[model samples]
Target: MAQVVTCRVKFIPLQLEFIATFVYVYNMKEDRKELWDHLSQLSGNHKEPWIVLGDFNVVLHREDRLGGNPVTLVEVTDFQNCIDNCGLEEIANSGSQYTWNDKQDARIFSKIDKVLVNGEWVDQMPDITAHILPEGISDHCPLVVQMLQSFSRKENQDREAMRRIQMQLQLTPLNATIQKEEKELSDKFRRSIYLAESILLRKQSNLD
Candidate 1:
């Protein structure tokens, strides 16, 4: 059985909007190909900033499985082909690299869960990441999709705010009572500059 749900999402704080699709798949080897084909067709139909994620029940690479039967090309081809055809790429992730683990003594682990997004999504939210939480009693780990505020976006907002403050300071006539307001504005402008520099340094370090 395979299920798919798609919806429009509005992130109010960031004012970011996009289409998100969730999929849950369960299929045998023969049926998996059909599922992949369906997903590929679905991706082709969507042109907006879109994200698709959930339990895919398959892996894309040999290293995604550990302490299990050696991964075969046949096991990965359909899923790889689907991703390639869909023009989707997995987002940056942290925490557990392997998302599923069998509880048995001879534990088997695999990364069958994934969060994938289209190029539009990447362009809109390049800093988004997925954090794989501890599985606990469940065999599959919980995935937390984090939409981080990009440094560029934050810097732009800060600069806009500072510009508004500067304009107000320039328009206001100098007076004894306005001295306090001027000082406050100056402090705010300095703080904004410092914050922008910090964000730039962090982005540079990440790139390095």
Candidate 2:
């Protein structure tokens, strides 16, 4: 079955974080553009830095191939177009370059696995990089993706706004039962109330 895997890296340089999604297609020949379009839609909706990686089955160039019927010229062009359209760049591949192989031929290898990142996310990863690792039990090799930390102002503001909204929602009972003493106490205990409100908000949001 085809599968999508994701991992998140947070706070390396200053306060930047990234969510990386890897798509591993088993035997499907889905268009590369379709996959990139899907990723683009997701990023537009979330408005967060994203890294997309995995074995796309299609190679972007002849340099990426090892042996045996290489990916067609048309396919390579399509793959390149997909990467360009998605606004993602391929990260460096390391170690034994080839990522996939056929059991029958030891020399049959191909660099199908790849690591891609959104251009906006480049600043967050200062020193870290992505590379291809060795294959163990499977035909495909594992990849190592190193990430750095850098915080964006947008994420911080979003969090703060969310906190304020949560605080307002938690003050519901206070509006209904505005006892003189209760209101006075609530005003005085603003810090404590905010903390309590935030905790509950996180919990409720998680449930939803």
Candidate 3:
């Protein structure tokens, strides 16, 4: 009953657009072909920015597994070939490196879960971070992806200073001042985003 969920997202105020496809692949090896085919078809013709994430139930290399039977190249190649066919690149994640663990008598751990994106998505969010959270109620860990923040060395220092200030102010009424300042900073960021979006729309309308 598990299928893929595909949706388009548009940040109307920012006029930014991207598509996301979430897949819960078949667990059996033979059924993987069907999963690969479904993804390949979606990624085939268009270059729209896309991010696909889920339990793929397949791995691409030896290091992706620990203990149990070693996966043959023949087994891994199908998933690799499918990624190649779709021009999808896997997003590297930290935290729980491996996603699934068969903790029975045999005991096996595998990195069969993933988040992948196309080159266009890479161009859009070059420093995107895909992080893995704890596997709470399932065998597979949850993956979270977000755009990376860019900052100058001075800016980083400034943020660290602000963090220290916030920590210190936590015991004082100045904490209210810090909170107000944080709200103002957030509003400024939103305003900048709106300005950028207006400029993008204006330029696009001019071209039209």
Candidate 4:
């Protein structure tokens, strides 16, 4: 079987770390743990914010699985411990009843996919939501998460306040000079009109 693929995306403005992984079916236990451990070590060491998401085949609890048999007790406990020990939080798992279905058997269904994140990343990020999208050709339902990346309200308002202060401070002598020049031009136009009228009056006096 082919190995799972992992990728990272760094958004500079938001100072975010987005780590993505896709795990294949065979040897899910060791492969998922190895992939997760790599991301988890990075999360622990780095001070900057980060989020991790992928197809984790093992379910953490009975609630995580929709209709599967509750027979794998030890595996479920180990998986839940892995998530907790890595300090990742699962977000919005109620959208789909199952992520994978038994092709031969219609009644058996299970959810083994999820989106997980750390605490620091969730604080600044908003409208972080996920839904199970339709996948006609594949066995796995597509996990879709809408990431709204922008400055928060407090940060934006703080920037506007600083801009107002800077503008007020810079509006000192140059603006005053321009206003004075405008008034002087008006006075010069009035004086020219008066002089023209006086010249016309003198010519009329001479004619009389």
Candidate 5:
């Protein structure tokens, strides 16, 4: 019920090793129960930062269905139970209440697409939000994630690295040795700044 693609994202020179999983899930409840089982087993496999985004082919609540036959409690429970079991938190979206639409009728609207993240991802990106885009060629509206990572990361990393330097300096007693370490730490700090700036420039360039 899921076709998964994995990729390693790299920023040149920094050599950060980050892996991203792109999962496209088609959970047609009538088609199979395998998907429900898969969702139940997913959260146990990941204990670190992660995100899941795509058309889920399911809606969590009655509000997710705008003009369809009144959503059944069974339907809502089926969709939300998977989310709850997997420990995935849906990121609140702005701009649109629903994503999927029946091509024939504007009245038939449903929010089946979403962006879900785990506890670690939430801890790292508390300010992230999902941006629901206008419907395109497909019956589904596109979605974009507005992330605070690029803006907040450099500041937080710099602060933590400097804190480490400060702690090391405090713990080392001898004045001459302290100055020596301070100079070394200052050099390392400058390199960190340069790397962070390079990454910032790349992000700005991409945005432009």
Candidate 6:
């Protein structure tokens, strides 16, 4: 059976900390129950923000597979039981729904790979998302997890400060002293605009 790895991650800028668990289940049906039991035990121990993700080698639902033998309740019960026991929720994802595809004329597609998080994780990072990239050479597609932190309060404060500065610049006469203040404020305003644009560009790039 594949080993389960757990680590603590700290986001320095946000002063946030969480537990991240990575899993790779052995592909055999009989071996998976032990893995599920182990994961459930781990989940019960961790109270902090936690995320577990990987190729589980099993589908959670019938909809998660296509062009394969019909998914039976017996095949999914163990996995579903583990999920409920762990209190883990699947992350919202974009791009392709199916993460694995057997490259053949009679193709088989399944969403065996997933990103799951606890309630604490959702409370800490509400905007977290997963993107499933197309499978190239490999049979399984790549999963890109993105955590978009909100800096709305800081951004709003900066915008308000800039607006006040602009009003002062517009109302004041262009004397030598006022001209110098104008130059300083203009530089600050331009810097803020540049920073905002940079942030927007970064988000757009992530989406692409």
User: How do all models score by TM-score?
Assistant: 0.70, 0.59, 0.68, 0.58, 0.64, 0.71
Model 6 per-residue lDDT tens digits across residues 1-208? 4657888998664456789888888888888888899888988887888999999999998899999799999999999999999999998999998999999999999999999998766544435789999998999999999865453444455567666766776787566676676666566455445545555666778799
Reference-based TM-score, model 3: 0.68
As for candidate 5, its clashing pairs are none
RMSD of 3: 15.1
Candidate 4 lDDT by residue in tens digits, 38-82: 555666675443556656667766765545576378767656665
Instruction: State each candidate's clash count.
Output: 0, 6, 0, 0, 0, 0
Instruction: Give the worst 10-residue stretch by lDDT in candidate 2.
Output: 147-156
Candidate 1 yields a Cα-based lDDT of 0.77
Candidate 5 TM-score to native: 0.64
Best by TM-score: 6
Give the Å error, residue 37, model 3. Answer: 1.5
Query: Candidate 3's error at 114, in angstroms?
Result: 0.4
Taken over the whole model, the C-alpha lDDT of each candidate is: 0.77, 0.63, 0.73, 0.58, 0.68, 0.79
Better structure of 3 and 5 per lDDT: 3
Task: Report the lDDT tens digits of candidate 1 across residue range 1-208.
Answer: 3567778998654445788888887756676777778778777887778899998888888899999798999888888888888889999899998999889999999999999998777544435789999999999999999856345564465456656666666777575446565666556455445544555666678799
Query: Could you tell which candidate, 1 or 6, scores higher by lDDT?
Result: 6
Q: Give the number of the best model, judged by lDDT.
A: 6
* Candidate 6 or 2, higher TM-score: 6
RMSD values for the candidates in order, in angstroms, are: 12.6, 13.2, 15.1, 21.8, 7.2, 12.3
Residue 201 lDDT, candidate 3, scale 0-100: 66
Residues 18-69, candidate 3, lDDT per residue (tens digit)? 8888888777888878778888998985787888888788887889999988
Q: Which portions of model 3 miss their true places by more than 4 Å?
A: 151-208
Query: Model 4 misses residue 26 by how many Å?
Result: 4.3
